[model samples]
Target: MIGFLNIIVIICIIVFALSMLGMVYRVIKGPTLHDRVITLDAFGVTLMGMMSLVSIVLDTTYLLSVIMLIGMIGFIGTVGFAKFLEKGVIIENDRDNNS
Candidate 1:
């Protein structure tokens, strides 16, 4: 039934929102760089889940592209942060050499 499905979607969206709030707290209260990075990744996942739920509730496919874009951005950001954590820099500069 449409009503049942809507109820389920609403419940799922609420859960996702609550989890996002927790993730936000972690990001704000994190005591280390790795903790913040992990929290950011969780935030991205929460955003993707919330967007998917919205798409479901709206009964439209328009948000699919947005979901994919978010996923790509999230993955890239996680990888970048991991590299930064490992190497201490995401981008290397050689301005001295250029000058």
Candidate 2:
């Protein structure tokens, strides 16, 4: 049964990789900036899933931290990109003083 489970995990990993490839293509050829940004976010999620599958196959806990790190980074990047798209800038400086 363990071997069967391993096979299933490997298959899932392969599927995730294929989906990531599709996401990458979308990111490169998407029709709009919003589409590309959404694709990039999906790609990051798929990557994390793939990494977790790898960790399961390897039977190690070392990758758990890496997975969390990836999630945080992906979230931040997506938010930043969205903010940039919405406001035309990621960081705004306030230089006006009326007091």
Candidate 3:
């Protein structure tokens, strides 16, 4: 049964890798910035999943924290990109408004 589980995990990892490759292609060839940003977000998610799978194969939990860190960074990056796309800047200068 352990062998069966290992095989399944390996298969899943392979599938995730293939999907990540597709996402990379989309990020490079996407028609617009929005498409690229979305693809990047998806790529981050795929990366997290792949890391989790690796942790499973290694029989360790250390990678879980790294996965969460990746998720947080990915979320922040996506939000920053979205804000930039909407407002033309990620961080606005409040000094200009006060003047």
Candidate 4:
């Protein structure tokens, strides 16, 4: 059973690596900001999957915190990029009006 599990994990890692390569290509070759942002988000998701697989193979949960941190960072980055695309900036300049 452990052998079968190992094989599955190895296959998953390979698939994630390939997907990450594709995402990198898109990030580099994409014609628009939105496309690049989407690619980055996809890359982050693939990274998270790979991390999970590694933790599983190692039989340790020590990477859980790292995984969560990566997820949050990815989410925030995506949101910021999306907002930038829509408004040309992530944070509005409310201070300018107050002054």
Best by lDDT: 3
Taking the tens digit of each residue's C-alpha lDDT, what string does model 3 give over 30-51? 9999999999999999999999
Q: What are the lDDT scores of the predictions, listed in order?
A: 0.92, 0.92, 0.96, 0.93
- For all predictions, the C-alpha RMSD in Å is 3.4, 2.0, 1.9, 2.2
Candidate 1 lDDT by residue in tens digits, 1-99: 679989999999999999999988989999998999999998998899899999999999999999999999999999999998898898878668966
| Model 2 agreement with the true structure over 13-72: per-residue lDDT tens digits | 989988988888898899999999999989888889999899999999999999999999
Residue ranges of candidate 2 with Cα displaced over 4 Å: 95-99
Clashing pairs in 3: none
Per-candidate TM-score against the hidden true structure? 0.86, 0.91, 0.92, 0.91
| Stretches of candidate 3 exceeding 4 Å from the true structure | 95-99
Candidate 3: lDDT of 79?
99
CA error at residue 72 for candidate 4, angstroms: 0.5
* Colliding pairs, model 2: none
Distance from true location, Cα of 52 in model 2, Å: 0.5
Worst 10 residues of 2 by lDDT: 90-99
For model 1, the stretches where C-alpha displacement exceeds 4 angstroms are 92-99
